[model samples]
Target: MNLNPDQVSNYVTKYADVLVDYSLKLVSAFIILFVGIYAIRLINRIITKVMVQRNLDPTLTKFLSDILIWALRILLFVTFISKLGIETSSFVAILGAMGLAVGLSLQGSLSNFAGGMLIIVFKPFKVGDTIEAQGVIATVSEIQIFVTKMITGNNQTVFVPNGSLSNGTIINYSMQGERKADLTFSISYDSDIKKAKEVLLEVLTKNPKVLKKPAPEVFVKNLTAASIDFAVRPWATNANYGSVVSDTLENCKVALDEAGISIQPYTIQK
Candidate 1:
């Protein structure tokens, strides 16, 4: 059936009213969203300041502040949409579906992010500490939201995901002030054990880096199939560990060679 011109005009006016109403509501929603986001940021800053005053870890405080702001902003957006007379249940449903898809797509990254949060909160290790984690030995350079940056002994920077790091074992060498350098060397069974001990003691006495209180230990540790093993355990500052080990090995070799002691070798047959 053909509609009359007057009736058609009336229908168009009704449609225009709905469009105008919807547009006004959308504009109001956007205004609330902008203002709410700014307010959330201000609140986040205040919370961050409070956390700092309470002596919270800076990393944890920053993370918590960000999460709080995000949560509040999301709440405000949902409220704004509801005020616009939109069915929020459908919006929430759509959001949940999209969130699930995103979460699945970034499952590993999400896990790492969660793990990073745990690390920051628990503080198993911090930036600048020498740590062994996930079979990588390096100094922690930075702790990020989903990964930890490490500088290896060879001056290589590595980014390790926090999920694997948190799930694995972490050896923090910087926790203790003093670290023991346990050196093991083998000698021929015919060598003079007492004389070898004397030579090691002399080397320890001359080294100023070695701690005097704990003192250095030199003793026969074990008798292997091919040679006798001697252990030289010494305590030194963690910073001097590499130097002490290198110097001690060089000096011990020289002293033993001068004293007519020979190092035994373990041979493997093909």
Candidate 2:
């Protein structure tokens, strides 16, 4: 194409104006990017401090802070792109769609994650706690985001999903710092009930593992055609629960035999 000198100058000026405009926008965008990054870091630090002040779980605090930081960075990127005169609404829409798709695909995982958050926040149980949930009685070994690892009495490890665990019933044996051992002892109907009660109470009281504040109790629970059942309850620290129950049962049998009270095996009558 052929043009006059004046026309060429006018075209060059027009192109220069466009270049300057774009350059200015690019500079502004970069400035915003750097400033936004600094702001994001500052916000993350503030949030972390707040979580620490609240004594939140370290893992959860870090996870939340990272999530927030990433989200802020994304927003800042969108802003920077918009400032550079690039369309961002479509990009944002695409991102939203992708997030939705991922969330739907990970529904169960998200639920578990939320449940874990609740567990960490509310603290239903802690590591080394003995808990009974979902028919599994085990000591919690580790508490993670999706599942809780537990070790059973037989040294077997089990992972319970936090989703169901948080929703279901949790029996924390160590929560109250004590546990009550419920025992049933059977005696021949001909045996003296008063003597049996005394013997069982004596056995419990003599056990050093049993707590004295609650003061072990023995009461007649039921009378059957075969024998009388005595309900023996002893309160003890979680550490001593097993020993207290076992020792009390052995001592009660011995004391009953010495007192001339006969104990009989309980049989189910059809």
Candidate 3:
């Protein structure tokens, strides 16, 4: 059917107005998005630099920056959608539902993520630190968002979940920059205790790896029916811990053997 002139003119005006308004809104949203991206990067860099200046751990700093950037970008996207004249209340509801679904499915990962964050914030341990946790003794190689990598004494690589690590007891052997190598030596009952102690002290002091500040300790620990036990401990830098322990033990045995202080096997009957 043919339309009336006035009716067509009014319809054309309304359609043109609607198109122009939507076009402007779309353009505005695009501009906001581009600007928002640049702003997010700028903000992330500024925060990361500040954290670096404060000597925050690099892993934590990077994780924080990425999280903050993601959250900001999500908000920016939401704002852009709102500009398109879509109902945000429904959008928010949809997001909440999706979030609930994701959270339910990823509870364990979320717990680990939170655990990792707590570890970073509390400074419980850092990269290159040796920590004992979860029945494993290893040196930390890297700290990630959900897991920590460790290198064992035998050159094994282990990945530990952050959730249990943060919740469990952690023995940090490298925190003090120095470690004590506790070595025990057994001597025959016939051996003179004074000679044994002197031999051990000499052995410890001669090792260049052992620290001289704390001084090496050598004393009669306990007397067994078969032998006398001497407790010997030497302080060494963490970097020298393994080598020092091995050297001290081997040297003590040789010194005792040469000094005629016999080391005999001792047994305790229960």
Candidate 4:
């Protein structure tokens, strides 16, 4: 139909006003987003600085900071979208569902993180402690949010997930100041048990690493079909445990051999 010019002008004006309003809202939304992002970054930096000053656990600090940043950014984005006059209830509901999905999908990771928190709070172990956990023995190098780093005696780096560590048994060898070294050696059935004990005593006395407080002693641990086994226990500082054991055993062997004591090697029977 051939419409009136005035009616056509009115329609154009109405459409132009709606476009201009939307354009203004869009510009405002952009401005808010940029400022909100900047503010989130600034707040995260401040939180990090505070955590550092307070000497908080590095893993937890970083994790919490990241969560705070993401949460704030999400809120800012939702607000920005709301400025454009769009419904947010469904958006929020979908976001909630996504969060639930993420939580379920990342259950293992979340468990590790929670385990780390428990370890940190309960003081079960700490960095630099020699620990045997989950069938692995190593010195703890770092404690992270989801995993604990360790260096074995062989100098191998191992990463243990905190979930298992927290739930499993942890033998902390370094927690105590001192430990006992148990050395057992076999002697011929005819060997003089008295003389062998004397030799072990000498070995313990000569070693500087052996602590004199607890003192060292030697006794017959067992008598098998072939030979008698002597148990030599020497107390030493945890720092000297490995070396002390090595040196003590070598000294005992040499001492017994020099004393003309018959040393019998234990033979496994078929």
Candidate 5:
């Protein structure tokens, strides 16, 4: 069947109109999408700058800014799809399902992240502070988003998960201005307690690093199976802890030996 020329022209014109309508809709959608994304990014940058000016923690500032930007961009995308006559309820539902699945898989990591946030906000221990936490003793090197980095006395770096750090007991040695050096020495029972105390006091007095405010304590602590234990508790600066400890031990031994007191060693019978 041969078609008339006028009929063919009318069909072409109708098809062109449909194509132009669709093209306009697509162009509108793309423009809105690009503008929305740019706005979100601009808002994120402004928020980050404001936070930085307010002296907020860098990690928290970045995290919150990124979250805000993503939330806004997602909202804009949903609105753009709705403008294009697409149903968004199903899309939102799918996103919710995917988010739940991902969250469940990352529960532990999320917990750790939350713990780290708590630690930062509460200011339990800052970097460079010596702390004993989670059965590990070390100086805090860095406090990250999910873990706390520590440098041990032996110069080894250790990373403690924030979840465990937040839940466990944290002993911050650097919090206090001074720390006590608890040193115990064993002497023969025959040794004179009064004379021993005097010698120990002399050792502490000779040491310039020992703090004078809290007087050094020297007393008989206990009577063990082999000898009598004497406790010497002295206050010292944190930086001089090891040095003072080593010096105290060496000087105490010398002082005791000079006073004719002998260290009682436990004897094992074969």
Candidate 6:
């Protein structure tokens, strides 16, 4: 079992070549990793700047940028592995399986996230907007990736899932910048219809909160055994809607009383 000098030299040279190749691969992988990280950061900053310039929502901009960075980093990781001559197909298969499992388990969350993206993109509502959705009328306090935060009239905080909110009907009360307050006033059947209409119209006209362009209207809405109802419709800026309705009601009562019109009780339809 004797080994010749030539045979020993050949073994030493082959092993040295393998070591050098591995060392080179290691250095290349590290260099690509550092450079890839820097490039991801640069791209993220550029994207953020562009989004800001376009006046995109801060929350959306950050979320999108983070997603892009992570995706890029994953690609860079795969490339680094490939550079080392390691089997990447199996690694990628494992990643795909994991992603699919996670996605299936988080269906609702993913749906909500997608819905949130739609809401932010389409802008059906915004913060401070009074909206009617999911059988609740509330002012939107905040909008997030998973849910919308609202403050109800009773001061209760509500968290509505974005998945349902985006898919369901939404009434944005503030989008039009104005609102109509539909009011009904009742009087004795014996009351003068013409005079009651005049009194009611005068009440709305005198209220500064009510808009003047559309002009307020008073008309006979219904007649019942107990009373005659007058429909009072007034237009007002969204900010003044509440005050206008309340003030008009109070003023109409006083005006009708002064005019000798007998007011009666009746249900008011919203």
TM-score of each: 0.77, 0.76, 0.95, 0.73, 0.73, 0.85
- The better-scoring model by TM-score among 3 and 4 is 3
After the best TM-score superposition of candidate 1, give how far the Cα of residue 28 lies from its true spot, in angstroms: 7.4
Best-to-worst order by lDDT is 6, 3, 2, 4, 1, 5
For candidate 4, write residues 1-270 as lDDT tens digits: 999999999999999999999999999999999999999999999999999999976766777798899889889989999998889999999989998999999999999989988987786777788999999999999988899999998999999999999999999988887888777788987888898889989999999999998989889989889889888889999899888888987888899989999887633210
Off by over 4 Å in 2: 1-42, 57-63, 80-85, 117-123, 266-270
lDDT of 1 by residue, 186-222 (tens): 8898899899889988898799898996889988988
- Candidate 4's error at 111, in angstroms? 3.9
Clashing pairs in 1: none
Off by over 4 Å in 5: 1-88, 265-270
Pick by lDDT: which candidate is best? 6
Q: Which residue segments of model 4 deviate by more than 4 Å? A: 1-20, 102-113, 141-161, 186-198, 211-229, 236-239, 264-270
Candidate 3 Cα deviation (angstroms), residue 205: 1.0
Q: Which regions of candidate 1 deviate over 4 angstroms?
A: 1-35, 83-85, 265-270
| lDDT of each candidate versus the true structure | 0.87, 0.89, 0.89, 0.88, 0.86, 0.91
lDDT tens digits by residue: candidate 3, 18-117: 9999999999999999999999999988999999999888988888888998899889999999999998999999999999999999999999998899
Judging by TM-score against the true structure, name the best candidate. 3
How does residue 265 of candidate 5 score in lDDT?
47
Question: Of the candidates numbered 1 and 6, which has the greater lDDT value?
Answer: 6
Q: lDDT tens string, model 2, 142-229?
A: 8888999999999999999999999999999888998888888899878899988998899888888999988888999898888899
lDDT of 4 at 152: 95
Error of 5 at 220 (Å): 1.9
lDDT of 3 at 62: 87
By summed lDDT, the worst window of 10 consecutive residues in model 4 runs over 261-270
